[model samples]
Target chain A: MAINTEKNSYTVIFAVVMVVVVGLLLSGISQVLKPNIDANKRAEKQKNILYAMGVNENQGANDVVFVSDDILQEKFDTYITEQFYLQGGEKVDDPEAYLIDIKKEKKKAEDPSYDQKLPLFKGTKDGKDLYVMPVRGKGLWDAIWGFVAVDETMTIQGVFFDHKGETPGLGAEIKQRYFMDDFEGESFLDDGQFEGIAVAKGNNDPKNEDKSDNEVDALAGATITGDGLATMLRKDVQKYVPFFKSLQN
Target chain B: MGLLSRKDANLILDPLADNNPITIQVLGICSALAITAKLVPSVVMAVSVIFVLGVGNVIISLMRNIIPSKIRIIVQLIVVATLVIIVDQVLKAFSYELSKELSVFIGLIITNCIIMGRFEAFALGNGPWKSFLDGIGNALGYGLILVVVGFFRELFGSGTLFGIEIFGNPVEKSGLYAYGYENNGFMVLPPMALIVVGIIIWVQRSRNKDLIEEN
Candidate 1:
């Protein structure tokens, strides 16, 4: 059978072949860049954690330090020694898996393969042993996630907050250092007790002067976001109070 | 089909001016509005679209014959998707940071109607080279309007180009525009792009009476 060029244009076949060629080309490129992209993501997550804990300046998104993979592991190891997970008040079988990809588990709950667990990262800064817990929930406009590091006694060491689709310059201030810096040295426990932090209005001047230290000032124009952050922190941090107490014992 | 080529060019070019995509067609209004807030990204988006539209047209046109008439749309889609992915991957590799900023918009190029429109109307019937030229032409036509609208938006919106402060900020560290010195809160919003595109349409119609008649 002779294929006639008279009726069938070689252009058509050429284009289809080109599509397959280009597809394979892009796949190859994606594979080559895969490690760099993955490394960038991991570095970014670590930088956010460090920034939240007041160890690094919150310069801006995309401004995080891009250290080599080896250095990153070393730096992360210096701070985060161990991690754990809990169910009700008992320890889960494999808490280590939670650290593999917290973002994955946080995004979906239907995956029974992932046991619902809170992964804790143990870190020591200035001779203080701090436990970092990841919390995620809905904000005013989109998803909000953060890392809160608490001392063995459960004093809040620092906090970092990130959101998607929040109003920029207003609710988005959660990403700003000024806002996160306030979380530093702010006690989660007030009056030798763990009532956690309260997000309040008007400088957070509580009626009870004693509770003021446990209050974080509300973002001027972002009431819903502030309240949402407070609500998320209250519920999530409360879950680990028993586990944190166990560490003390 | 010989006589059709002449008629087709007229039909396509007519919509570009009289039935303008951004203003009249409003087909790709989303990116038009969002990216216009910043000059560089808007320009980048425009160029990227032009590349995709032009190349997609050429590819689809070349494949017009053996495209199996029943599943033509699928063939066009495969070609378009392939081009979009290539562009998306290229953007990520070279401009990793900017790619993150653009986020889903790059991937959404697959859904862009201008690209699909070119494939359906022109590429499917034309030769490879003509389809390529027509793709570039339509993309150029689309991009022309975007840059013009984006110029005004970025100038007044943020007083910056590619995030560089073009208009020397004032004593209060405010830009040339007193109202929108810090940032044009309005320009960042998607609706502002619509308003800019709307004004461009109004201007085009007022100048070209032919456009008004079509409207």
Candidate 2:
């Protein structure tokens, strides 16, 4: 029997109907899964922070243990306190709208206030108040973002890095716990001045007479990525300087 | 609608062996080259692809009759995008960290040629059952290459497989896998994936010379 797979009215109508049905079905399923996805993201962020703090004992980056979503949420509620924009040395009055997503605003260059609404995460570790501030900037070929936890005096407690397009083994080493460990106990402020962090290159002996806590060696082979990171950190860290200073009083 | 059956399982299995997309057809090599660096992610990607391709094929075939020729491509796209979004959302909900690791690649599946090609070429004229089988067969074809590439990249790149240390590291006080050959860090680089893919294609062509011929 010769089947007429022609583009007749019935065929076109059927196709449109089928497409709509499938679209609706998939959307419904996606709606059902949305909550799970959000939970996962929160848990992963916690896992990364723990790894950066050297709390995870696994040798490979893969072995960082993740607690269940319920447990993670419970811990997060009790521990992590999400802070929004702190302008003029005071936390924003209405932080709801100020919880800006920098990712969504990158394309538009019109708003100067866009840069001020900083999203900060604060929690406790080892009986000390650890304030984790978010930072974002360019890497050699892509964007790099991370969380830096600083103690009461603005000294670095831990750092967690995630990048979009940095070269592996070179710039991508930022994701390694050892690289982040280098930041522990380092100072974001030196001599009462906010000097921020530095990305130097090579065997930068922190013991070398000239090296200071504000500077750490960059990955050897990724010069562009390293330079990009240094520039990005310089710019992003400055945005939170006021917020950090306000906490002192 | 009834023309496609397991009786013609060759229609499905043949692609995996000879008309392999990643190796022979080279239809969807982008993901293979990028995500193969890690075993867990590569495996997740492979499963995601299989899911999308299989579903897209069956849906497109079922709706082939009603879709307007002038707007068929757009209709196919809607179907593909919907499936990709569902998979992405499902991953996010159930395995958030793994989903993050998979990242934009899951969304990128919407553009993967294997799904589009199967829908347009094979599924548009077939029955839902036949299209589903064809989808699995073609996905297997693409997935075989992904697994091979992912295995090599993860094994050598990270000095481990699925995060487990296969070769001991004397430097890290683990063991001895030849003092300095602990981990071939180069395997993790994207360029290494390209080279590995190139080798797979080379081997595939050598075994089946007919694949080299332009159809």
Candidate 3:
């Protein structure tokens, strides 16, 4: 009340000082918490990869429980035997391949000259070899991404979908166990030809009993997100067909 | 009651009903509709709003004297943004899963009109303690309406509460579904939320004749 707060000079000075103080505070906090956040992200990635390969602690039908955080490293190490990437038809082993930013790689691969390094995790679950590949795409509201685990025949063993900002109870239901479970036993190849699975509406297979048809029953009120998922599978999963075919030879 | 006087108690209690933020003031209806489709997200949004508003009000009230009236709006905005970011970063670091669930809603908290409305109308003039109480009161009021709306929306819209099936499995045709009852998909949409809020307002006004306005 005593100070002349109405002055333009006073207003400008206050604004500048406030901005500086807030900026410093925010930056300091972010710097200190970066490690923890990064660690959480890494653990989440491991969990998703493992989940896709069906190495989880799910006890109930609807549960999507991942390996616990305490033993996450151990589980990841034991199950994920190798982390590698496919670049220009060559397999390159990379310990940090799982950490590759799919969004950045997708953007860079837009140019014809860039050979995008598609990261894939080779894991052994229940005495069967599984390859988990990460896929990213646009959803109804924002970005949607997931891990798809397939066998040598490119048949889907399992999948784990996640979204950044999809509508809850609608598009967001893509991550639910029921939705993700439908992808199991679905093959990306139809008679030795690449045929990406579709999240089709009116497929009339609500029970998802017909996996060989290359279509899964779509979530109601989530047409755009379902289409996005199908497109994402076609665009990203199609890239690994050569690698799987080489394995067969 | 021992800690606060009747006047101070009113600051924290009045907004819960007579001056409810969503139903009465009509502030922050956007979020009330957006996240209230489910009970879990609605509760989370409410708790986040309570924390941000409480801390924000106190900060604004403390800086009330020095804040230039010309740029006070900008200052308030900065405070809300800063608090929201801090909350978001901390949640990401400590509770990553929860932070993911609340991804967009936390940022949406910055745009909540109730935060700014309180900062301008109450915090700029009131003392810090009073402002904090006011913030808590308004947020609770908003949250009450949100929870009520969310309860109906999730139950009718999805046949569930907090993801727990109340009417058994619709797919299996059990419980209410056996009687040929179907989940009202319209109840999940945003427009339905508006209608639900309108119904609440109508019920409240009818019960208390004092709430009705003569135009």
Candidate 4:
């Protein structure tokens, strides 16, 4: 109490000390959690990769044999045998797939002669080869991304989408399985042409669409997000078409 | 009287009823509306608020004398913000899914008003231990309303508590639900939360005449 409680000197010192203490404490906690957070994120991507490849939590390999959370890492390592990158209709071995930050690489897309190596994951399940690519786009509020899986013939097996800050109960439906299931069995191939899955603004049945094979029902009241999803899928998937076609022979 | 004085006990009890932060004082309603759509998130928010407010109150009270009145709010905010960040980190580490569900609300706890109100009104003038008690009182009061509203909302809206089906899977049990036992989808909306809290205020005020205004 000897220090005057009303002095500018006191306030400045207090502010500095408090900031240093809080900053150090938060940094320390974040440092301790860095490993686990990274692991969780990697595991989540692995899970999505498996999910996109058509592996279910409890319906893969025999009548049961579930791929629970603890086993997702192991399953991913086993199923996804190889990974590589492609740059402008050519296969390459320069960059790894999992490490590519789609959010950043997405920026290079604005450049016409974009030469960034795009990642492609290769896996096999039940004798069927799977090719997967990560896609990113802007949602209503923030970034939206997904893992898209397709077979050698350029048909979508399944997809796993998640968003950073889409409006809950409305635009956030993209993350739900019910909404994602709509993408199941849809193909990027339409009559021997590359056409990515389109998220329609209408919830009309897939059979009712003019291009039923390439369209899925959109979330009601979330047209922007649906359109964004379509744009994200189209632009990102095109990067992997060369690699996928290269493996067909 | 010892530390377990009637007055100190009243600090804990009174807010649970008469001076309730959510229903009575009408503070910290944003979280109540946002997180109450599910019972689990409401409980988590309640526990988090309790920890942050209680610890922040004690920190502020201990520093009350030295805290320049000019920068006390800043100081209080620092304490609350640090505690909230720690809670958020722990949730992310351990309760990852729950953390995802709570999302921005956990960070938003720094602005819950109830915590700041107690720091200014009680912690500034009281002993650290007393302020700690007052903080718990307010947290419990706020949490009580959140839990009640969450319980009702989740029960009727989702036909579940903490995601457990209580009405025997309302969607699939249609043959058994011949009498039309359907989940009230409207109860999940934000306005329904306001109505639930209003009903609580009505019931509490009806039982306690002191809550009624003279006007």
Candidate 5:
């Protein structure tokens, strides 16, 4: 018996049932997979942090290979000596500092009275002490974020940039080796002034030899993404200067 | 041929050439143009579309009879979106790195008209088995064009295929580069994709005169 399918009542009932069914199915799948997805995200964060501090499995000039999963936790534990964050200008030790959400902190800090927790990882690579900081900012299409590892002098040791929805060939190249490698040896301070690096065009130093100038050659077609990255570095890294200065005293 | 009858086989074969979703029908040109810059991404997107369309066709076909005509489009959209999301969540759980690489493209699958086009045009009037075959055929047709376009773009634009240097290193001035050959930077841009697709359509129509419309 074919029920009258053209009835408005049938259409409304079908729509409601479909919505409820789809909602339940999607929510159930998400709930079941939540733990595994969360674990994967945690592992990725650790990998990114480790990658920024120059501890990675990269072999080729263009490779950005992270350490394998089997030894990732071991490597992370061995390399990262201290995990802490600054809240109200006070240092607080946190074992899971890397997992802190920078986006949420940024939103909360907009209240002005809220003291945002700025997570920092201290590690030693090649017997030289390094500090790794996470930064979040805008890109052409969506959010872009990265981890930057710097030494006591605030010179960039290594960086690992990633984006949520940047264009594949253009803005997406920020994560590529050629662009990220240029950040190395670039100092955040110029003669003790906290002057951030700029992704400049026609800086006349395409080879990036003038690290002291606080400028890296910009990507060919990715002007806005490059500027966003430079701004992100300047704004986010500026907050940590006070703590780094206290280290000297 | 051995498994399927002549009529059934045509359902799987017709879209591959004379009635292709991309070339002949011009249904899903948007994604074909957007993600065909590199061979790997093109292949990945093709495989993803194949999965979504094939499964989506079957689901829509199974529900064709009871689906209200007034809200059938919404129901079809829900099916495609649900499938894409499930695939995305599963990939994120098992293969986080690949999920990251396919971040935007996976979401873009729902927007590909081929899935909805197949559902509305064919699956709504067909059985599950035949609809499945049609879905696979159209997706294969789309994939073929994508791979072809990706091949030319990546080779000329980056001097690489699947990220392997086929024309040698452009930066180090090796192999073809040593002979003063330079990568065409324009080929990597989106406009070049349209030109490449246009060239494919021209070549296809020239070979098959029947496809030419009488104006």
Candidate 6:
């Protein structure tokens, strides 16, 4: 005798069973793989932080360099010397800058104190010290983030930008070296004022004459995303001004 | 029919050419357009989809008889989604970069329409083994379109295939680059992917007379 599989009671029972099974299956898999996923994300973040400090993959025209898992960890340890958090011009007790995610922090609109803490990474290579600052903001469709590094003079040393869902070939160019290179050598302070870099749109050809002007040519077809990057970079950099200035004394 | 028999072989191979899920049925074209810009992600997406479709078909087919007809769609979806989530988690764990490149497209596989179509049209009515073959066939069909588009897109759009420079440096102005062979930037966009698919369908229809519609 075949069961009445199409009965309303059977349908409801099957639905409940499936929901429970799928939920358990997903949760189990996620739990088992959480450690590995977390490690991969941390490694990638370390790689980007390294990139912002000017440590790119082995340079060659056509050669692709593949760093093993151990070497990646070793490289991060060698280049980055210190990690700490700064809140209201004072160094906080948090030594783990890698644990804080600015993307998640940006979502808590109700938490006005969310911006109080900013993670700062100190990296050194070739006897030169660098401060790596993380910035994040909303792009055309999703989150855009990057590490902007500076030197003793507060000039932009290098940048490594990335985006989640920005339009490819347009706003996605931020990840490309050429776009990030525009920020190199650009100063953050304008005559002792904390003036951030300006991502100017449609002003591609000699936009400004002042050499000390903190301005860079924005992506041609990605004005809104460029503007978003500009705003976030300014806001994030401004938060650490007091801490950075305190180091001089 | 026996496994790998003449009839059974057609069940697996026909979709690759004459009856492709992407070209003939026009299913799962969104991912075909979205992830084909780079060969690595396209290949990964194909592998992920094949795994999901193949396992999903087998699981759904085995339970088809006991599944409540009123909730079959939900049942098929649960199986497909469970498999996709597994693939997503594994990708995140092992190959984070590719996972990032694929991003939301991997999660979007549940809505691809090809897997669900296979479940409703074939898996529900066929045995587990036959449904397994059919699922692999349709997925390979979809993979063919995606890989082909990815090859051309990466070649012309970036002067590279799988991130390897093929015809000298496209960015350099000196040496072999002065021939003015600039990368075709438009091929990287969504509209160009649709155009590439149209070209494939056009070539396919021309070769197979039965596929062409009467004028």
Please report the candidate that would top DockQ against the real structure: 6
Model 1: per-residue Cα lDDT over A7-107, one tens digit each: 44554774567578877877897898777666566566776566555566323432333343456666766766665666546665452432456556555
Which ten contiguous residues of candidate 3 chain A have the minimum total lDDT? Answer: A55-64
Where does model 5 sit among the CAPRI classes? medium
Which residue pairs does candidate 3 place in steric collision? none
Order the candidates by TM-score, highest first: 5, 6, 4, 3, 2, 1
Off by over 4 Å in 3: A57-61, A201-209, A218-221, B155-187
The residue-by-residue lDDT of candidate 5 on A48-161, one tens digit each, is: 999999899987678899999999999999999999999989999999999999999999999999999999999988899999999999999999999999998899999999
Question: Which ten residues in a row are the worst by lDDT in model 2 chain B?
Answer: B170-179
Q: Write the per-residue lDDT of candidate 1 for residues B128-182, one digit (tens) a residue.
A: 8777767776776777777887777777776666666677663345545466445
Estimate, for each residue in B1-215, the C-alpha lDDT of model 2 and write its tens digit: 37656555876888788877777677888888778888888888888888888888988887676666777788888888888888877777877678767777898888898888889899999998888888988898888888888899887766778877777753454655665566677888788888998988788788877878777
Report candidate 4's fraction of native contacts.
0.58
Q: What share of the true interface contacts does each candidate keep?
A: 0.14, 0.61, 0.86, 0.58, 0.81, 0.89
- lDDT comparing candidate 1 with the true structure: 0.70
TM for every model, in the order presented, reads: 0.71, 0.81, 0.90, 0.92, 0.94, 0.94
Local distance difference test, candidate 6: 0.85
Relative to the true structure, candidate 1 reaches a TM of 0.71
Q: Write the per-residue lDDT of candidate 3 for residues B1-215, one digit (tens) a residue.
A: 89999999999899998999888889999899888888998898888899999999999999999999998999999999999998899989998987887787789999999999999999999999999999999999999999999999999999999989999888778999999999999999899999999999999999989989899
Ranking by DockQ: 6, 5, 3, 4, 2, 1
Q: Give me the runs in candidate 1 sitting further than 4 Å from their true place.
A: A1-33, A55-99, A103-117, A122-131, A139-142, A150-157, A164-185, A196-228, A246-249, B1-20, B23-25, B89-96, B147-155, B166-183, B207-209
Residue A136 of model 1 has an lDDT of: 77
Which regions of candidate 2 fall more than 4 Å away from where they truly are? A1-27, A48-85, A91-122, A140-143, A165-170, A202-213, A220-228, A239-249, B1-6, B170-173, B178-180, B202-215
DockQ of candidate 4? 0.49
Every model's DockQ: 0.14, 0.41, 0.61, 0.49, 0.67, 0.74
Misplaced by over 4 Å in model 6 are A58-68, A104-115, A204-211, B1-3, B173-176
- Scored against the true structure, residue A202 in model 5 reaches a CA lDDT of 100
Chain A TM value for model 3: 0.98
Q: Write the per-residue lDDT of candidate 4 for residues B1-215, one digit (tens) a residue.
A: 57689999999988998789998889999999999999999999999999998998999899888888898888888888899989988888877767878989999999999999999999999999899999999999999899999999998898789977677655456433556777788899898999999999999889989889897
Q: Write the per-residue lDDT of candidate 6 for residues A1-249, one digit (tens) a residue.
A: 578997899888888988998898889989999999999988888888888888767465432233456688788888889998876566865557867887665565348865556789998978999999998887787889999989867888888888998888798888876688778888889887899988886554454444476888888799888988998888878888887787777
lDDT of each prediction vs. the true structure? 0.70, 0.73, 0.93, 0.83, 0.93, 0.85
